[model samples]
Target: MEKIPILRMGDFLLVTIQIDMHDQLALKLQDDLSNAIQQHASKGVLIDISTLEMVDSFIGRMVADISGMGRILGAQTILVGMQPAVAITLVELGLSLPGVATALNVERGMEILRRKIAADGTDERPG
Candidate 1:
């Protein structure tokens, strides 16, 4: 099973999804992300889904779950690089990802995360 690499970036965790993940891999990513959030005490999470060509209901739900988990762990989640068609399909499939925040690209997402963390005044990352 291939694992998604979660990178620690200052006060955030970055996850770039490049491949079409299977169920197991997705589940593993959720677990790993949660653990990383707790271990790092990250202030935010940025997930880049640019290379993901398709997103079914399950994957969409997983993304939402990740966002919710991040919230519970005192981190904000911003999903980026979602293609227009993918967004439409997700909405059509009834997976609007209610609790998740989104940005057009990674750069924008990073900016959003930085601003959020700054406003919150709680930098969870250890020096």
Candidate 2:
């Protein structure tokens, strides 16, 4: 089975989805990310899906679920780099991806996460 790499950066977890997603891979990501957030006490999650040109209902739901799960585990989730068509397809499919915050790119996503962490007074990084 293939796996998506989740990198830990300070109080955040970054996930770049560089491959086509399947049911199993999505499930694994959800499980791995849940564990990682708890293990690292991460404050945020940034997921970049720029490489994916398309999305189905399952994938959309998975993304939404990941965001919701992160929130439940005390982490803010930001999705970034979504292609225009992919977004349209998701809306057309009626998968609005509720509760998931999005940004145009990784940089913007990271900024959003940073602001969120700072506002929450959870910035534990050393200066």
Candidate 3:
């Protein structure tokens, strides 16, 4: 029963997946992230998945769901750090993660999220 941590950084939430997540853990993470977005009134979510070597359909769907949920909550979601092999496997497994924003690393992800929030007129002022 591993719990993923959601860290708050200014107007964004950072979710760093440090281990290969299982089904239950992934679901819990999705729930936690949604709650954090609302609780913090976050403008964005950056998920770092660099440590994961593989992802199943369940995990892939969870990631997609998290992105969708973030959007519904008025937050932008960026998934970062996907290894090339892992990404290829996800595509081969038919999980392209449609409508999800991806980046090569956390730095780029933050830049994208910030730009999207600004473009959406989210008013990301210091609180």
- Highest TM-score against the true fold, candidate: 1
lDDT (tens digit, per residue) of candidate 1 on 25-119: 99999999999999999989999999899999889889999999999998999999999889898889888787889999999999998888786
| Candidate 3: tens digits of C-alpha lDDT, residues 46-120 | 999998888888888888899999989988899999999999999898988989999999999999987876776
* TM-score of candidate 3 versus the correct structure, residues matched by position: 0.92
- What's the number of clashes in each of the models? 0, 0, 0
lDDT of 2 by residue, 38-123 (tens): 99999999999999988888888788898999888999999999999998888888888778899999899999988877777765
Q: Which stretches of candidate 3 lie over 4 Å from their true place?
A: 122-127
Candidate with the greatest lDDT versus the true structure: 1
Residue pairs clashing, model 3: none
Better by TM-score, candidate 3 or 1: 1
Q: Worst ten-residue run, lDDT, model 2?
A: 118-127
All-Cα superposition RMSD per candidate? 3.6, 3.9, 3.6
lDDT of each: 0.92, 0.90, 0.90
